[model samples]
Target: MHRFFISPQNIKENTVCIDQEEARHIEKVLRLTTGDIVVCFDGTGREYQVRLEGRENGILTGEIIHTGLRESEPALKLYLAQGIAKGEKMDTIIQKSVEIGVTAIYPVSCERSVVRLAGDKTEKKVHRWQTIAREACKQCRRNLIPEVMPVMNFTSLLEKIGDKPAIMLYENEDTNSLKALLQGEQFTGAKEIFILIGPEGGFSDSEVLAASRQGIVTASLGPRILRTETAGLVAASIILYEYGDLG
Candidate 1:
């Protein structure tokens, strides 16, 4: 069945409204007729099995057949704090990370970050990435859409991390592997987990020290260094697997 993310307000007692781009997709592209079944979610961890009632005006409407909690969400709340990369790297990272079950994404501006977005441009970029995350959620059957936060400064990012159990992926780090860090520590009942990755030029020595001082563990993917885009996905996958969410 086709799945879509709609607003909670659009959902009535027994009816759901699909409008805007989604309405266009259903009416013009899919050409789904009345009685055609489609799954709809409101990004609130609930999904409704609805039957198309056809388009009314510019909006497409559907009758809710059943509603239930989404099961695709992982039990762990995994957050990815990624150093903003250049070009399409950030886009790819957000999309794939959402698919891999990241709860939310924070774009950090490190000393070595190549692409620095500010003011109006940062807002626009954040909107674009959020759209990518939503699209990825639709593709991955994720009931909850992960948020792509506005670009944050490296220092500000560390401050926002608070006292959460977090780890940073540092290319220079040789000893503490990701596996060893998780295995060595007991973080049971940790509802939230933060994973940080550097940009194309990687993190500077001072940034690593700052993160380390903020109680974030610096770990390595392995001896082989992965690109900025690949590092987060790998770390998130390993974390999810370790926590019993992935195989």
Candidate 2:
């Protein structure tokens, strides 16, 4: 069944109404009509099996046949605090990260970052990335949509990281590897794990130290260095696999 994420306000009693963009897609593109069944989620860890009842004035209403909790989400809450990359690299990162089950994404502005977003431009880009995340979730069958946060500077990003278990991926680090760290410790019941990846030029020594002061452990992705976009995806996948979500 096709799945879509809708707001809770659209759902009430035994009926759910899909408006605006989703309604247009169903009526004009998919051509799904009355009696067709589709699965819809509200991003609150619940999905409803609804049967289309009618469409009028660009609004599609369906009768809720069943409602249940979503089980596909991983037990581990994975958060990605990635340095903003240039062009399509950021888009690819957000899309793939959501597919791998990241809980949320923070676009951090690092010293080496080439793309700098500010004012209205930053808001527009964030909106675009969020749309990409939503589309990716639909394609990947994810019940919850990952949030693409407003871009944050290196120092500002650190303040919000708090004391959670975090790993900052730095190429210079040779002693601690993500694999080695996970293999030795138990993270099965950990509520959240933060993964930070630098931009094209990677993080400077000073930036690494700043993150370290905030209780984030600096780690490497092994001997071979991965690109800014590839690093975070690989890290998230590895963490998910280690925690048994990939199996």
Candidate 3:
């Protein structure tokens, strides 16, 4: 059965409404007719198997035959504070991060960041990244859609973490490795995590110091350096695996 995302507002009383792009995909692209069965999720950890009843005013309505909770969420709440890269890189990072079970993504604007989005452009790009996240969730069979937060500056990101356990990936950090830091006492039974990765040029010395002073631990991903897009994904996976949530 095909899977579709229905907004919670569109779902009510054993009935689901598929409107906008989803309706078009079912009607024009898939050509799924009445009585055809499909699965729909509302991004709130619930999934429904629905039988397509009919279409009215370009919206597809279905009778939900089954509803249940999905166990696709990770036990740990992993947050990614990524320095916004270029268009394709950011898109890839968001899509793959969702697949790897990242809880949320915060796009940060760093001093070294090449791509700068503001005003309507920033809003539109955030919307696009969120869409990518949703599609990735659908592809990965995840019930919860990871949120792509608005772009924040380095300073703002520090304030956002707020007493939460966090790690800032710094290339200059030679004393502490990711494995050592993760295995240490700081992360034991931590319910939430925040991992920060820099942009193409990486973070400046000042920015790293600022983050460290805010109680974000600075750690290195071995000796080899990865690109902006690759760093966050690798760190997120490692963190999930360390928590026994991934293989």
Candidate 4:
């Protein structure tokens, strides 16, 4: 069945009203009509089994047949604080991270970041990234859409994520692996996790030291260096697979 994410307001007593854009896709593109079944989620862990009622003036209405809780979301919440990369790489990272069950994403501006955004330009880019994340949630059947926060600088990110079991990926950090860290006594039943990945040039030494001082555990992703975009996604997948989700 086709899946879509809609706002809670779109859902009424026993009906779901899909607005123009999605309605057009169903009516004209998919050719789905009355009695056709589809699955819809409210992006808040609520899934509804719906049957099309009819379409009028670009609005497609459906009757909710059944509703249930979403089971696909990981038990652990994984947050990605990624340094802004060049071009479409950040887009790919956000999309894939959503597919892998990330709960939220924070686009951080680091010292080595290639892309810089400020004022109106930053707002536009954040909006674009959010759209990408929404589409990814729809495609991946995620019940909860991962939030893409407004861009933040490195220090601000650290301040916001204080005392969380945060992991900062560093190529030079050889003492600990994420897997090993998870197994240690310090980590147990940790529900909220923050994973930070640097940009194309990676984090500066001073930045790494600052993050370390804030208690963010710097870990390595094996000997081979992964690209800035690849590191976070790879680490997220491994972490989800090991501790909470990704079955």
RMSD of each: 1.2, 1.6, 1.0, 1.3
Residue-wise lDDT of candidate 1 within 23-95, one digit each (tens)?
8888789888899999998887898999998777767899999999969988999999999999999999999
TM-scores, all candidates, are 0.96, 0.94, 0.97, 0.95
lDDT against true structure, model 1: 0.90
Clash count list over all predictions: 0, 0, 0, 0
Q: Which ten residues in a row have the lowest lDDT in candidate 4?
A: 181-190
Sorted by TM-score (best first), the order is 3, 1, 4, 2
Model 2 C-alpha lDDT per residue in residues 177-215, reported as the tens digit of each score: 898877765344577899999999999888998888777
Question: TM-score: which is higher, 1 or 3?
Answer: 3
lDDT of each residue in 70-184, candidate 4, tens digit only: 7888888889999999989999999999999899999999999988899999999999999899889889988888899999999999999989889999999999998898777
- Collision count of model 2: 0
Q: What tens-digit string does per-residue lDDT give for candidate 3 at 41-155?
A: 9998999999999977767799999999989889999999999898599999999999999999999999999998899999999999999998998889998999999999999
Off by over 4 Å in 4: none
Q: Over 4 Å off in model 1, which ranges?
A: 186-189
Q: lDDT per model, in order?
A: 0.90, 0.88, 0.92, 0.90
Model 4 sits at a Cα RMSD from the real structure of 1.3
Model 1 superposed RMSD (Cα): 1.2
- The runs of at least 3 residues in candidate 2 whose Cα sits more than 4 Å from the true structure, single-residue gaps closed, are 185-189
